[model samples]
Each structure stands twice: as C-alpha cells, then as structure tokens.
Target chain A: MTLAASPHHILTVTVENKPGVLSRVAGLFSRRAFNIVSLAVSPTDDERFSRMTIVVDAESAPLEQVVKQLNKLIPVIKITEVPPAEGVERELMLVIVKAAAETRGQVTELTAIFEAKIVDVGYDAMTIMVVGEPEKLDAFSDLVKPFGIVELQRTGRIALPKLARESTRLRSVKTARA
Target chain B: MKLTGAQALIKSLEMEQVEVMFGLPGGAILPVYDPLIDSSIRHILVRHEQGAGHMASGYAHATGRPGVAMVTSGPAATNIVTPLCDAYMDSIPVVVITGQVAYSVIGTDAFQEADTVGITMPVTKHNWLISDAQDIPRVVREAFHVATTGRPGPVLIDLPKDVANAPMEWYWPEKVDMPGYKPNVKGHPRQIKDAAKLINEARRPVIYAGGGIMLANASNELRALAELTGLPAVTTLMGRGALPDEHPLCLGMPGMHGNFTAVTAMQKADLLITLGARFDDRVTGKVSTFAPDAKVIHVDIDPAELGKVRLADVPIVGDLRTVIDEMIKALKSERSKQDPPDLAPWLATIHDWQERYPLKYRQEEGGPLKPQFVIESLRDNTPDDCILVSGVGQHQMWASQLWKFKLPNTWVNSGGLGTMGYAVPAAVGAKVGRPDRMVWAIDGDGCFQMTAQELVTAASERIPVKIAILNNAYLGMVRQWQELFYEERYSEVYLSPDLPDYVKWAEAMGCVGMRVDTADDVVATIEKANEIDDRPVVIDFRTDWREKVYPMVAAGSSNDDIILGPEFGEGGR
Candidate 1:
C-alpha cells in the first residue's frame, strides 16, 4: 500500500501576554519534536494577550496531539487550525542577489515580473523585497536562485481565516427576499 | 485587605483548602516562608528538594487531590526537575512553586538565579512567572485549575523575590478564564451506542482499563461494566487496583511483566474495550502483533491518546466515569435481550491459561529466599488496606504481580517514568496524607541507595512509613538483562552486600531497621516493622539475587514470545 503523507497545517494560538509564555510554547513544540515550519507572534488589540500563527508540518507529528498539548498550556487562551484553502497566508522575503552592471537589467526585469520592489542597491548586489503568499515567495525565490544570490531572509508566514457572512444571516436574508 | 504577595499566596492556598505542603526554604523563598508562620497549612521540611516534589506527588496519588511543593531558586529549582518529569510522565496533578531572583535582576543572571521557568517549561502542563504582586491570586487559582483538570499533570509557578515582597491588596479571581483548556467530559451518544454494540457482539472481549479509571474515580463503574457484561478485564501497571484483585473478572496487570493469562488473552482477544489507557510501547509489545485480531473501542479523556499509537474502531473521548456511565446505560438495554451472546467458552479458555501458567516461583528446601516468595509473605501478613509503593526494578514488578490490590489508590509506584528512587518519599507522603493506613515502600538495594536520605525527613516528621528493602546485592533487573541479552558479561551491576549496612544506616537516621536473611524471618520481621507507628522502620530482606521476573516479553518483541520461568516446566527460557 502507498503511504499517504499528511499535509502541513497552520495553527493559530492565542495566549496571555506574560513573561516566558513564548518560551513555554516553543519549548512544547521542541520537546515533542514537531517541526514548526514558520511562526509569527504579535500582541493582540488587547494588551493582556498575544496571538501566534504557527505553520506546523503535520506529516512529521500527529497534528491532533500537538493541538491537544497546546491546549494544556495555561496561558494559551484559544487555538484554531486554519485549513490551507479557508485561510489567507502571507510572507515577506528580502533577497540580496549579485547584480553587476552586466546582470542588472535581467535582475530588474525579473523583479518587475514578480512585482517586487528594490529595497537597496550596492556596487555588486541589489536587495529586493517581495510580499505575497508563501507559495508566491517560494516561486520568486526559485526564480532568483540562478542569479548567484548573496543573501536571503523571510518573515515566516502569518495567516487569518477568510472573512465570510454567517450562513444563518445569509439564509435569513434570502428568506426575507423570497 | 492590603497584604504582601507572600501573604496573598498563603491566603489563596487556604482558600483552595490546602492542608499540607512539602518543601525546603532558602534565601529567595524566605519571603514566602515568613507568611507560612501564621498560615494554617502544615509544611513538612524535606531533606532534599526532590523529596519535596515526590512527596507532593505521593500525596496527590493517595488522596486524589493536587499535591503542593515549594522550593527556592537555582540549585533547589534544578533538583526538583526529576520529580516534575516523573509527575509529568505519570500524569499526576502536582503544583510546584519555586523562588526566583528579583524580577529586576532576572535577565542579568543574578546570584542564585537559574531561569526556573525556562528549565521547567517542557515538563510542566503549564507555568507562570509572577512579575506583578496583583497577579498572585489569579495565578494561584489558574495554577491549581490547570494542574488538576483534563489530563492532569504537574504545573509550576515561579515567584520572583521582588514579587513576593511587593505589597498589594489581594483579591481572588471568581472564575478561571481558560477557554482553550476545556476537556471534553461527555461522550457522544452515537459513539457510546457504537461501543456498547461492539461490546455486546464480541465473544472474546476484554476490558483493558488504565489509570484513567482511578483519575476519574470510575472504578465502581468499571467493575459494574465488567460484572454486568460478564467480561474479563486486565489493567495496565498504572491501572492496578481499579478493580479488586479477587474480583472474578479481574485478570490483573497486562504488559512486560504481567501475568501469563493477561498476555495471552490480549494476543487472542477478538475485541478490546480500552478505557483511559494509552497504548504505550511497553503495553503494546511489537505493535504489529499486539491484540492482532481485536477490534479496539478506545475511550480516554484526551483525544490525542485515542489514535496516537493504534487506530480505534470506535473512539470515545470523554471523562472515563461519564463515558462508562453512558456505556452502562446503553449496555443495560442490550443486556435485557433474552439470548445474549455466550462468552463461556472464552472464559473457560482464559481459566485454563490462568490455571496452567499461574505466576510461579519455588524455593529449594533451605536455599535462598525467592523475591516472589518474600512478596507473597508480605501480602499474606500486611493488612488488606495497607498501601504499597515500590521503586522501579525487578522488585517493583514482583510487587505488581504478587501483591493483590483490593482498593483504589492503594498501589502508588512510579509507573510511567519508572523512576528508581521514588518509593521512600512517596510512601512518606502517602502516610502523611492517609495517617490511618499502613504504608510500605518495597524497594531494591540499588533503588534504595538512590534516595535513602529521605528517611531522615520521614523520621524527623514522624511519618511512620515502613520501608521493606528487597536487598539482592546486585542491580538485579540489569543483571538479569545482562545475563539474558549480553552473554552474562556483567559490567557494573554488582553492589557489595557488605557495603553500608542498611540496618546501621537506618539507625543513623533514627529509624528502626532489621535484617532478615532467611524465609522463616520474613513474617516476624514484617510484623515487628508494622508494630511501630511512632517512627519510620526499614526491614532489609536479603532475597535471592539470581531470581528474575518471569513471563518476560523480551524488549520490543511480541507478547506472544513470553518466556516463562523454569517452574512452568515447558516454556523455560
């Protein structure tokens, strides 16, 4: 029988904003050997709490177990697993590539095609910023790999569920129209 | 009322009805200790920080309440790590408080500062670092709540010295605001019905109960389910005493050192109704062949445990008591049917296995006393209500196999982590919690030497726990393994029998210690130890070092390959 690999899952965890809470969460993932592909953390509107968006490779560990363990942490206020299709994900990438006078035109044209902006330019290299979905960033990175890239960095992915009207409200509105 | 953070912490513990706590005091924690002078909570000063934590866990295991331990920073915090990990592995509810350097000096690595929260993060269910004085009450409430609920485990609260000294008006939180930590306690009706249907349809069914039954206080429901369905039940090491050992349906423990009947029953089972038990590697020997033909009905409070190792035909995630109650109700309807499926043939086969390969050990006329014989003598002499705790080794397995546990929470060993030096302090904690019951710590010489210092605490505190050291001279379990797997080339497994005479050592700690070398002295020595209730006593029974725990399933092998002892005649290893 062929093995069916599990997909990567994105989990959003909200926790109380206290000292060492981040360490506690990160410590749990490390202890369980669960790979955190990408992670982003920021304080919520309420200063008392913080929200973390974590992209975990479910293929390496049991996702359900990971979520259950996350819930056991006291400071954690909530957890939600956003399906890839139902969520909007974005990442920021900065790539510094070799762009001598000879390759400058080709690099600029490729940057334009990807809708990226040139952030900085040195004598031998040009640094460009790309902001888009993770997949788009991956594609841009792949396209720039052959240009003798000097440096690359990415702001790990952050995600939120796509907004939609409640089904009950939509149903009521349709009934009223009818 | 206006109060210091230390006073507020004490008051909050009083509000939680904490009667006893175990710990040691040091410089950073002196502020908290000051408030304890006026508080009603009785604090037992431990010999070591690790003893404090294990004592608290022992209290939790015996009383089914969250145990409390408090210690100072740096070395003190680091010393308690073993107990925290032990509690985590066993899923015991224990709340440990450690002192930290002043909040202002946290990142600077000030004197006696060890990043307590950082070190304990992975082991605890949750933890907090108190920076604000006002956060004390809420943190205390949340700590206890998180420690005791769901899949219970240890929780830590690190109090900076500055926070303890900071003054604020204490106000307890009315309710905990943990939205993510709600444990599912009610089984779905459809799943309960499905589990009942499966239970009713199977011919060779077994109820595999684990520690969850005791955690949920569902032993009565488990017994009722087993008796109502006329099904045999086998417990995991942690699940021992969920049903009275004498109960007709009880098949005792099933795992690495479990009885022959239990091992074979699981191998041949058609359906397994597992409750509150994770399929740990030890229990599911060679997972591919474990309960090979059984359709599983896995029920546990933690959803992760349901399919962590093996898939369940019908998974029920909820509190064991609640789920068992629902299953009983559903099974009651099925029981009303005129022609219930007969399990007589299955029970007869199990009876044959039980009778044919009963846990056996024989002593040559006047030869060395077998460890199993010693355990049997202890069981025969001790009161039925006495509590038995053991350190991990051949002795622990012997106690688990030979001792007939007839009540819940009576057998308190380090089951999950298998910590070697758990018995002495744990027994002391149990005796402190249950002053009316007799407590015994059955240990091996190797295990006893690890934490024997705790006897000083037990003697000074007047906790009258009995320590029965099954002295085999060698690290018996490791020696047996070396003999079987490593071509009998023993390394460092041997400990000289003359070193540190246990009796003299016990006397140095103010305990009444006795040495029994012959089988004839076992009963009299145990009785003498039991007679003394004013101070702790240690009885050293020199058992045969060559004897090994039988019905052994070689590590990582299938349960089908259980090697019985020579006494079994045909299946000698």
Candidate 2:
C-alpha cells in the first residue's frame, strides 16, 4: 500500500556565513530537484553563521532524503524539521499598486482593513507592506490585483517554535556534590 | 615575513605536508608554478587537466591520503570537472587548486576566465575563492581538513591571479576554526547495543559492505566482525576489497553485474546489516522489492545515508572502524554459545546459488579471445598485491567480477561517476604513489581512447604502469544496453577497429606496445608487459565483441529479474 503523502515541512538549517554557502545549499535543492515552497535566509546571533528556514512540500520529494543531502553540505552545521503543529510561521510582503487620485481613498480603506502600512507614496502609486502567514499574503495579493498592482516582493516564510527552548543541545556535566 | 600570494600558497601546501601534486600549467596558473622550483613538493606535469585530476584521485585511493591537483583558469578548470564529480561520487579525498582571472575582472569576462566556484559548487564537498593572499594558509588547512574527514570527497580552492601576485604576511593557523564542520566519530552506545542484539538474533543474516570500509581503513574490523559472527559479506563495486576475495565468508560483489550468489543471497536474506554503505540504486535494484523480507541495520559516518533510501531499524552514525570495533565489543560482552545465530542453512543455500550460476564464459577453440578470458588470465598472472584500475564499461564490470582483490586499496576505478578514460591516468597516479608496487590499468577500447594520451606522461616520468585494452571495437556497455533494451538497434556505439592502431600509438608515446588476438597469447603478453618496469606498456587484446556481461539485472528492475547469459540456456545448460 502506498503511504499517505506527508504534509509541508519547515527545516531550520544553521551554516557558516561564507560567500558560497548560500549557492551550495540552493544548488543542492535544484540539482536534486527538490522543490522549495518558501525560503528565508538571515544571519544568526553569532555573526560567523547564518540560519535558513526552508519550507518544503514533502509530497513533492522525500523529506528524509532532503535532510540527508543538506547534511552532506560542508557548511551546514545543524538541521531540524519543525512540524506545523510545533511552530508559528510568518511572511512579509511589499506591494506597490496604482493609487491614482480616483481610488486613493478606497485603497487606504483596504490597507486599514488588512492592517497593512503605506510605506511609500508616489505621484501615481502607493507601496503597502504586509506581514502574515503565506495564505494571508496570497489573499491580499488577489484583492489588490484588481487595483492594478505595479510591483510585489515577498520574504519567504520564516518560523520559530511556540515553546521556548535551547536551539541546540549542549553536553551537560552533572555534579555529584549536590 | 611578507610573501607574494603564490609563495604563500606554496608555503601553505608545505605546511600540510603535501609531498606531490598533479597538474598542467597555463597562463593564469603560471605565477603559482614559478614558485614550485623552490618548494619541497614534487610536481608531475600532466598532458591534460583531466588527467591531472584523475591522477590525484588515483593517488588518494592508493595512499589513503588527500591527493592534490592544480590547473589553470577557464578550459583547464572545465576539463577537471569529470574527475571532481568522480571523486565526489566515490568519496575519494582530493583537493583541487585552480587559477582564476584577476578578482577585479571576475564578472567582466576577462581572458581565460571561468566562474570556478559556481561551476564546481555542486560537485565539490566545499570550495573557496581567495580574496587576499593572507587567507591562503587558513584556507589550505581547511580544504585538506574538509576533503579528508567524515565521508571523504573532493574540495576546490580557486586563486585569482591578482591575489597570487599581491604581497601579504603569511602565518599558519594553529587550528581550523570551522564550527559548522564537526563529524561524529563514535556511534551511540545504545545504537551499538541494538546492532549487536540484531546480529545475535538474525537467523539468515548478510553483511552488505560498501566503499566506506575501504575509505575508513576498516577492512580488518569488517573481516573480524564477519568471521566472528559467521555472516556472509557481499561488497559493492566501490567496496571490492573490504574483505579478501578468497575469504570463505566473502560473497564478492552485489549489483547489476554482481555474482548470482551475492545478488540472490541479498534478496533472500532475512537480516541485512549494512556497514559504511549507502543503499545506492545500483546495489538495490528495485527499492520496493529489494530485501523485501529483511530488517535493515545501516551504519555510516554520514547521518543522512542511514534513512536516505532504505530505513534503518538500528541506525548508527559514526566512523566505520570505530563503530565496528564497538559492535564487536558489545557482542563479546553479551556473548553466549547458545545465542549465536545458526547460519548453516543459509550458507548451504548460497552454495547452491553459486554452483548453479557461477560467473562463466566459454572460449572458442583457437579463435578470438573473450573479454572474460583475458581478465581471468590477467588475474591468474598478476601478483596478489598488484593494484588494478579500470575505466567504466563492460570491462569495468568484468574486472570487478573476475579479478581477485586480496588487499585493500588495490582496486581503483571510477565507481560513482562511471567515467571513461579514468584508467590510464589513475594507474599512473597509483604507480607514482606506490612506486614499489605494480599497477595495471584494465580498460576497454572505448574508454581507453578517452585519456590514453596520459601514457606519454607515465612513460616520460618513468611511472612504469601497465595497460591492458580489452578491444571490442565498440562502446560495449552501450551496445549491450541497446541489444537488450532497444531491440538490437545499434546506433553510433562503434569506434573503428583499426583507427590510430593502438600498438603504434603506444610506441609513439615511448612505451612498449603489444597486441594479443588469440586466447593462448593473453598470458604471454601480460608476462612480457610485466617484465618491462623501466617504462609504461600498453597491450591491446582483441576480444570478441558479441559477449555481454551476464547475471544482469536491467537498470531499475528488481533483482528477481536477473537475466542470465546464453550460457545458462533453457533447462540451465
């Protein structure tokens, strides 16, 4: 019997902050033909390293195999998969749309309703920034599309666990005096 | 002391104790080469950049040390891509240095420029592009460290011409500060205990070992564990000499061209304990049905390999030798005479498969020789420790199947990349690395033509490597595939039988050349080639083109679908 397709998985990978490390990771995904649904890369607290939160569809490729291949990369220090139930996820999107005098009021109302901010105002356009789950951004984009969107950019989904804990385990030495 | 970037690079290599390097020089790398005269390291100039890369891999395989290769920018770097991929696939430790155009003109497409880092990113374990000469020593240390540790593979370091010319202070780093690269060397205690428990209980157990054993130098531990447990061991092509071929417990190779006993034994086994082996697609014919009834225990230095293909019931991530040593100790602590698994029935079944489908070939009386006959004769004539290298093709499979590998690091081939033209250059490297031992390159006509020019380097340098060309007048492996899968519609697989004439070609390269057409002449030709140790030699053996490797499992098919050759006709004749 065929196993049920696994759900979307978020992998948090820590790697050395070197020039080609990003290309090495991205190249591995493309070469292996593993689809990355969303990706967010940023520096970690330690300047020497960076962390990438990669969202992948397990149905498209085996998650275990992806993890293994990622581990093979020399710069990759650690990788952990966060199930949807254990994590909170969010994405940020910036959209520049037509805001001619005729529809400026209506656009402002829509922005207010979505809790988006008017980051920039040009003669004929306004840039709105929104931060939320991927689905929320998709819905916002669809609603704004009718208003003649000029440009849009999205930071792929980034996530963290709901429970506070150490990011990685450190060896602990127990004392017998106590 | 202040030094130019090229001098700093040379000093860095010296710091790592690099004894020899294989390379070809050109405009971009000329600055680096100028410093070679003063360095203690020996440079063996190759005829081609690809030859230099494969030679480095061959040196690595023979010596169990990180081999080094250097080449110039653009085409020179592109030429070595095949060898880099080959080393990546087989986990051979090699560090390749490439010259680059000046850093200022990198993106502007200057003369003889290539995006070395981007082009080699996927094929290399790691790579670096030098921004300044001061980074040379630290980067060189890290390059060798990354190349030789964990699951060993090739690493690249690209040096810009401007950086090589720039002056800077050189200092060796006391330690490599790579926080992201720590390898797990010790298996988890609990996992070791579980593996030992499985070994203690498996009724029909099989030990499937791969190149990891050779890469880790764990042959002794593997042999000890196999004998102590009375488990049958089957090697993958890369894992050929993990155990001596004559060992009673050894079942030879297991895969498409693997022996019948080894292939069937794996399919019939109840427990498969894989050591330092990834379940490659070649080894596991059809993943769904392979070892369908067996529970797996996969141990490897790379954590991802354990469950990448087949799920491991007792997955242990650690160094192969250390894990095996731990396993033996755990088994010993829990040993009971009554607890050892009874393997007699399983051994008897394996014996039956061996008897029914022994690796076989027939020779027509007083006619052209078969490739198998040539390989068998070569095996009979060579010393036990003679290092054998093969290029990829029907000849590669035949060499893997027919040769008796009694020692580790003695069988070198392009296993992962399945590259053609690997034999001649690699044999040269092997001979250069082990000057006291004999090196023979068993290659096919199609594969031999790819990198045969490297024989000139071997001859000129006095490497004394021997070559045996199994001349079948075509790309035999592809022809076999077309015959079996494409209904015998042979396309452009043939290379003219008399083209360039191998004997004359070898002689022109300043080496002794001989041709053997009949089965009777094979041994004499080999003996004559073996006798000439002052220079390299090439022997062209005109073998029958019609013969195909037998006991074949067509790619992507289940092991159960193994096709026997005509020799095992209807009613198993």
Each prediction's DockQ? 0.59, 0.59
Candidate 2 lDDT score relative to the true structure: 0.91
Model 1 pairs whose backbones collide: none
TM-score of chain A of each: 0.88, 0.84
Candidate 1 whole-model C-alpha lDDT, 0 to 1: 0.90
RMSD for each of the candidates: 2.9, 4.5
Docking class of 2: medium
For residue B442, give model 2's deviation from the true position in Å: 0.7
Q: How far does residue B197 in candidate 1 sit from its true spot (Å)? A: 0.9
lDDT tens per residue, model 2, B133-245: 88999999999999999999999999999999999897899998987788889999999999898888888899999999999999999999998878899988999999999
Share of native interface contacts present in candidate 1: 0.78
Candidate 1's C-alpha runs over 4 A off are: A1-7, A44-48, A162-178, B337-339, B570-573
Best by lDDT: 2
Question: Model-by-model lDDT, in order?
Answer: 0.90, 0.91
